[model samples]
Target: MHISRQQTESAERGPRARTRKLMLETATRLMQSGVTPSVSEVAEAAEVSRATAYRYFPSQAALVHAVVDEALGPILDWKADVPDARARVGDLIKTAMPRIDEFEATFKAALKLSLDQWAQRQAGTLGSEPQFTRGHRVELLRDAIAPLTGTVPNDARERLVQALSLVFGIEVLVVLKDIWGLTSERAQSVAEWAAAALVDATIREAGNGA
Candidate 1:
């Protein structure tokens, strides 16, 4: 019986993939529960050795980043199906807001880590820790507004992107839930409305040559 090289490679990769998945799932659960656990802590919770967890995630930032990717799974790949820029932006908001609400805790933890890194950098103690960078929205939002590139003024396109960013993420949760005490459904409706309104207002402002 001949086991092909591909088969051999797949067999070798199987355990590594499973280990990585297990660690990631554990970390996601931890962050979802509102605990920004370190790798070693995740190992304990996952019943894996510290050495194993460290091998998978070298630092807390890495672990948190993994959790974020998992939380943002489908949203990260979102694309507009419609041709209309307004409709596309609206569609993107409708698609992403629910996941943002579902993984609310995970995103909150990621935001806190981002803030912590900024403060640490300012205090000159950031050291060699890998920065928990976050600007995916820049690309995602820009892509969502791709249809508006030449139709709207360049600055207006950018202004729409910037304005849309304000309605897209954890900040929505903070405003609608923490501040306004709205439930997730209501929060989502408000986000959807705000996103549509922003797109409409930006286009109208551009049309008026403002």
Candidate 2:
């Protein structure tokens, strides 16, 4: 009997997929307990060998990235079918802000990892750790502004995306709740207002050729 390529690939992927899922779930559980656990720690907790764990996550950063991605799965998959740019952006904010609040601790841990890696890199001590790249907000913002493709200049749309990012994630939570002493409800309201204002401003500027 001849084995097809699809069958071979699927067979190969089965164990790898299960292993990756196990590691991710183990890491998430550990992180939820209020500490950024190392890969070895997660492996130990998950009852998987260190060698197997390292194969899936080469570093703590890589492991945290996967956990954060899993935590953000819902927002990353959100979509708005409205035609108005402002409405689309508002829908995104409304959908995302609550999830961010719900997963505040996870996001904070991820942010800490990002900052720690940054500091290590600046000190030339970052060794072989994979950098925790952050671009989910960029993609989300782009989708939020997709309705303005023809109306707003590409450059202006880019600017709008950039501006909206500032008010989108945990940073907004920190700024509004921690620094400004706003309640969660108030902070979310402000973020939504700022997002809508930025969208309107970008459209106006684009029309004015600015």
Candidate 3:
């Protein structure tokens, strides 16, 4: 009897994994389709019971975060092999921009969730929902600028990271493509140029102690 119970538990694990994957994939498709769906909406779209979906993702924030993480899997896996800080930053921008473009809607939906949470929190209506904080760009920018540590002061490194964040994500896409009406290639080129220029200027300023 105990052996049968153990086998049943093992057998149940596969379906649980499949259910979670289905929920994530469904959420991604919805977000990519330009709808920032709630967990229940995703569950309905996935043909999953709302209860089951909630078991996997308890709230809208959790669901949106999972979708964002899925879309960012490629960028998260990126590694810079060269040691030059400027070259590394350029490489990261080149690698990231294309993927960022590919997942633009997903990232934007994630941003919307963040903004909504911020507004709710400010109004003291945020309740018990988990907060969705954005930090991927912070870590990625720091890594891209890691080779600058010996030459640039820690504070300056942080400032460079802050500056690069301006051009690093879907917000840049909106500024460059939507507002400026630049082509995708042009937008990417501009961002890469800006990133490299920031690295050079930051290093130069540090050298002069300015």
lDDT to native, each model:
0.84, 0.85, 0.87
Between candidates 1 and 3, name the one with more favorable lDDT.
Answer: 3
Clash tally, candidates in order: 0, 0, 0
Cα-based TM-score, every candidate: 0.89, 0.87, 0.91
55-130 per-residue lDDT for model 3 (tens digits): 9899998788767777876687677878899999999889889988998989888888889889999999999999
The model with the greatest TM-score is 3
Q: Which 10 consecutive residues of model 3 have the lowest summed lDDT?
A: 1-10
The residue pairs that clash in candidate 2, if any, are none
Q: Could you say which candidate leads in lDDT?
A: 3
Worst ten in a row by lDDT for model 1 = 2-11
Candidate 3 stretches greater than 4 Å from native: 1-13
* Residue 134 error, candidate 1, Å: 1.1
Prediction RMSDs, each to the true structure: 5.7, 5.2, 6.3
- Clashing residue pairs in candidate 1 are none
Q: Which regions of candidate 1 fall more than 4 Å away from where they truly are?
A: 1-13
lDDT of 2 at 182: 93
